[model samples]
Target: MKIKTLIVDDEPHAIEIIETYVGNFPEIELVATCNSAIEAFQILQKDRIDLLFLDIKMPGLLGTELVRTLKNPPKVIFTTAYQDYALEGFDLNAVDYLLKPIPFNRFLKAMEKVFDGYRPINRQIVSVQTDQNKSENFIYLRVDRKTVKINVRDIYWLESLKDYIKVVLADRTLVSKQKISVLAELLPESLFLRIHRSFIVAVDKIDSYHSYAIEILGKELPIGRNYKDACRQRLQN
Candidate 1:
């Protein structure tokens, strides 16, 4: 019933603040407080941590790098003094990003997200068969005043239409009044690529690519100049 948690920070004061905040949450149990990423890794190897409060910069291994090494990492709440790492943290699907000096109320808000994300919801589960004919991940979207489950494999591409985004599937399209950037963060980055400012394509759905554009199901999507290099790199390898 308790969420086993770890706090990894180089600063003693930072660790103490997190410890004090953790004490206020009855559902959270602080199992370990590590001063370095190296120590955190060792603890993670032997323990089952439900949540991790990780600091970005450390002496030997940065918190972000340490997280990349894990095959099945726990829900992470990144704590950092600098806002520069926020994008990277989000890309890693972190539970939350806490900027120092962290307020107690802000820390509590982050903990709430951990529960909201990991806790199970009572609903009809949607399924999808992938190219390999195996069942894969599903995402929940709010549509028509209810939460609708959509399989990730069914999504061909996403197009941004100003304030709203069109989720294009094999058979139909669904429109949601959500920012493309926030929606992109919810998707698996390895399976999807932001090929343009207004488009995100499923990498597997891509048929062919050139310097200027990519071909997907007989449609040519122009590769934005700013994203051209990154898109080319992902497509190549």
Candidate 2:
């Protein structure tokens, strides 16, 4: 069953980001987007929305206030720039409270919580595999409006850009909206190494390494002071 979703945010860019992320999930169907709490409240009265991506601060009525008015509210994931509203958002029983400039992976985690409530009876079984069989693994990234699948083996390195990550491939580079930490967690530990706070490199892609830097694709990336010990250990092995 597709989850009927609605996005309510004052900022157009915020709504666009959420919309792009939501589009990647085939299980979710975005119903509408509203710029104000009052506009969203009107839709809630008539439509049966399964999920709501609501922004807390609006001009007139707050997103939290809108939820309070609904006797039978849908599952809500609150999005806001302020951390002060987190306690209040959770007190109202929100599924998740996302801060602005939301990472794609964080948004993905929030959606997973929503899916837990409506788990399918015939869930697909995943086959168990050994570490040696993980070379075929790949991950889907939200690039522009489409989700792009990237093979783990093709990745040369990854560079952190605050809220985004630049994924360096063998032939091309793709900039994705996600935190490097989140991507690091997804990658297989044996094949990838975090060489610095701003960079992660595929172990196999490194041509040479010294005390302070690593050479890959004829370019050098610095090794972070804290990660020097671990980087040396991984590369040496």
What's the count of clashing pairs in each model shown? 0, 0
Q: TM-scores, in order shown?
A: 0.50, 0.58
Runs of candidate 2 exceeding 4 Å displacement: 121-146, 149-237
Tens digit of lDDT per residue, candidate 1, span 159-216?
9999778898989888876667656755778799998999999999998889988888
Candidate of highest TM-score: 2
Task: Show where candidate 1 strays beyond 4 Å.
Answer: 118-237
Residue 212 in candidate 2, Cα distance off native in Å: 34
Give the Cα error of residue 40 in candidate 2, in Å: 0.1
Tens-place lDDT per residue, model 2, 3-96, is 8999999997788778766767777889999999999999998998999999999999999999999999999999999999999999999999
Least accurate 10 contiguous residues by lDDT in model 1: 123-132
**What is model 2's C-alpha RMSD?**
8.3
lDDT of 2 at 193: 94
TM-score of candidate 2 to 2 decimals? 0.58
